[model samples]
Target: MTGALFEVTFYLAAPFWALMIVAPRWRWTTRVIGSPWIALPPLLVYLTLAPGDFAELWTVVSRPDLEALRAFLSSADGAAMIWAHLIAFDLFIGRWMYLDARRRGVPHLALAPVLVLTILLSPIGLLAYLLVRAVTPEARRLHDREREDQPAQ
Candidate 1:
């Protein structure tokens, strides 16, 4: 169980870091990346609830010699770290999405609240954004045109 949990955390972190690097250059990559902010909570919950053995595994892998890092690995600090990471990641994803929407000509004023909601309550925020995007006739037309322009396999 410890190993499994550690793997899960790594799994959640890996693609996020990768996308952090890749998404800047590739607009299409953003679609595949989903939203790391929204995706991290369940993994954090799993980490918080899993047994102590998971901490031992994580510490061994991380090999954090600093006092702060060690403290963070401890059960009490671990929860704080999880919450911090979640908020930070969510904010980053929300900002990125907001900027992306703006670059795509989606109005900033309309997108700002949705981005804020996503940062505060990820899944629902994402659902609201999706629903709005889907229902907007112009957005739907653009999406359909993009689909039609796809090259044949």
Candidate 2:
């Protein structure tokens, strides 16, 4: 069951990722991603796997011990739970990146690679998007305009 859940976790997130990366400009893509609840299914899996050993899970997280954390994650259930957590958050982040990039007028060509990177390594993908967003003309112009409108501090 744990193995199956782990496998299914990525499958659940894959369609969303596909929409964001493949058919990014499609009307259906925007409509589907418009709902942030897309992240819920994997989270449900996480919740299901969590109750099995809540005490160990809590202890591993609440304390700073390396070995305890290692032991907890070494278990099948623990690994599966973490995988679901990662999938849910990654999809959420990808959704935000897609919507924000489109709004900022960052071309889909540039955003596609970053979205792909997010699937493999989200922190790095987020960093890359930040750099891209920072340099994008529309995004920078919008930021400057917003700053100008703010009351002087």
Candidate 3:
């Protein structure tokens, strides 16, 4: 049922989050996270739910009317569709953050909490990660090194 699908959407993404947060140092984590498809399950749910209400959704999106959007979101199906969409994008964002952190040699300790925050509140989590990324010595050093390696104009 729609309710069950709504409830299970987050579960579909939980394992990938577990790998990124709980087993970040594991070699398989990187291997597994390498595929951007990790976000596909919830996205599939979004796809499944979208066509049922495509007309209304298109209207809500295209016109940007506050009352119309509120009405759209008031329905169970609309809420579920939006939830699935959020879960998929959040996982995708989290994956990117994890991979970028690893590449920059940002310590796992610093990133773990950020990933958790991303799960709970992505905008804040993204801000926190950006702040961490900006201040991280390794990230700055890598940026400088990469800049130096570029051929001068």
Candidate 4:
């Protein structure tokens, strides 16, 4: 893809991911935004940093004679573009997870070690937090009382 097209794609995708973070009213957005699979676009772009590979992929869709597309993808600028997208998307997802944890009343002390672990090893920290949240008596009680307190409407 040409540099301009790559930039446009990044611009479009970044805002969609950002909306996942900032738009709290839309809960489903969280799932879409937080899924690490969103990393694919930038990863694909990163793979395209080698022009020959980019051309090969493009050839699957259209004419192979688009040498400009190949050159653009091969450039260092393309790699930088991919890097920026990956970093922004990852940070947004991380921030969203942190905020969600805090909103759930995960205590700062309990959350500290998890946060550290998440930074160093994401899956383990996430699983640990899920297990802890699941079994936490206080969390259970709070949820139970909240449900009990709900007014019939």
Give the poorly placed runs of model 2, Cα more than 4 Å off: none
Tens digit of per-residue lDDT, candidate 3, span 1-153: 779989999999999999999999899998999999999999999999999999999999999999999999999989999999999999999999999999998899999999999999999999999999989999989979999999999
Candidate 4 residue lDDT tens string, 51-73: 54445445533764557555544
lDDT of 2 by residue, 26-123 (tens): 99999999999999999999999999978898998888699997888899998899899999999999999999998888888889999999999999
Which candidate has the highest TM-score of all?
2
Ranking by TM-score: 2, 3, 1, 4
RMSD of each: 12.0, 1.1, 1.4, 10.8
Off by over 4 Å in 1: 1-54, 57-74
Decoy 3 TM-score against native: 0.95
TM-score of each: 0.49, 0.95, 0.95, 0.38
Total clashing pairs for each candidate: 0, 0, 0, 0
Higher-scoring candidate on TM-score, 1 or 4: 1
Error of 2 at 36 (Å): 1.1
The whole-model C-alpha lDDT of candidate 4 against the native structure comes to 0.55
> Which of 2 and 4 is the better model by TM-score?
2
